[model samples]
Target: METKEENFPNDSTMESIKSLTEKDAKTFLNLIYALIKDNENPSEQLISNVLTIFEKQLPRVAKARQNKN
Candidate 1:
């Protein structure tokens, strides 16, 4: 399997990760854990659910960053 470094060809992704707040980082980790919890590939429904969550979160994240600026 390709490692994360191999998956991301540039350092910008790592830099963005470093900028994440602790809570945001934990939320991402939790999402990853949830996806891999069963030690098997996540089901399509679960992927759909996660994508829905991201869809809901993106605006909130953008709003929060806008507020910070």
Candidate 2:
């Protein structure tokens, strides 16, 4: 019996959600949860990896999306 309070991610989570695509963000969040389910140390290597990919594509995506406006 989980409460509504336990179902929502906090502000930082929202920000991360905003930073990623809906599909990718959901996948990422699930992966993070799985990693933590083991109760082991969480290294942000996957995050850094994703950010590297995003940062590389950032300029192009921004330009393309901006042009659509």
Candidate 3:
């Protein structure tokens, strides 16, 4: 898949973070570390805040598949 910054909302970037794939998640985790690792202050709380507004598409997809059964 193409990784485009514009693919997501700038105003709600945190919300978008929650919906990332496993690979994307790993990449993002690394990014977070890179941003804060040097400061001795990486915030897990910030990550959770982002996830709070994030919606999970996998569950919806699974539900749709079940409905098609």
Q: Rank the candidates by lDDT, best first.
A: 1, 2, 3
Each prediction's RMSD over C-alphas, in Å, is 5.8, 9.1, 11.6
Compared to the true structure, candidate 3 yields what TM-score? 0.32
lDDT of 1 by residue, 14-41 (tens): 4445556788778876976777685454
* Number of clashing residue pairs, candidate 2: 0
Which pairs clash (backbone N, Cα, C closer than 3 Å) in model 3?
none
True-vs-predicted CA distance for residue 49, candidate 2, Å? 12
Which candidate leads in lDDT?
1
* Candidate maximizing TM-score: 1
Error of 1 at 20 (Å): 0.4
TM-scores of the models, in the given order?
Answer: 0.48, 0.32, 0.32
For residues 1-69, write the lDDT of model 3, one tens digit per residue: 637764454543444454445776675457556655554434665544334333343344434444766
Ten residues in sequence with the least summed lDDT for candidate 2: 50-59
Tens digit of per-residue lDDT, candidate 2, span 1-69: 869875455554454445555666566556656655654444566545444444444444445544766
Better of 1 and 2 by TM-score: 1
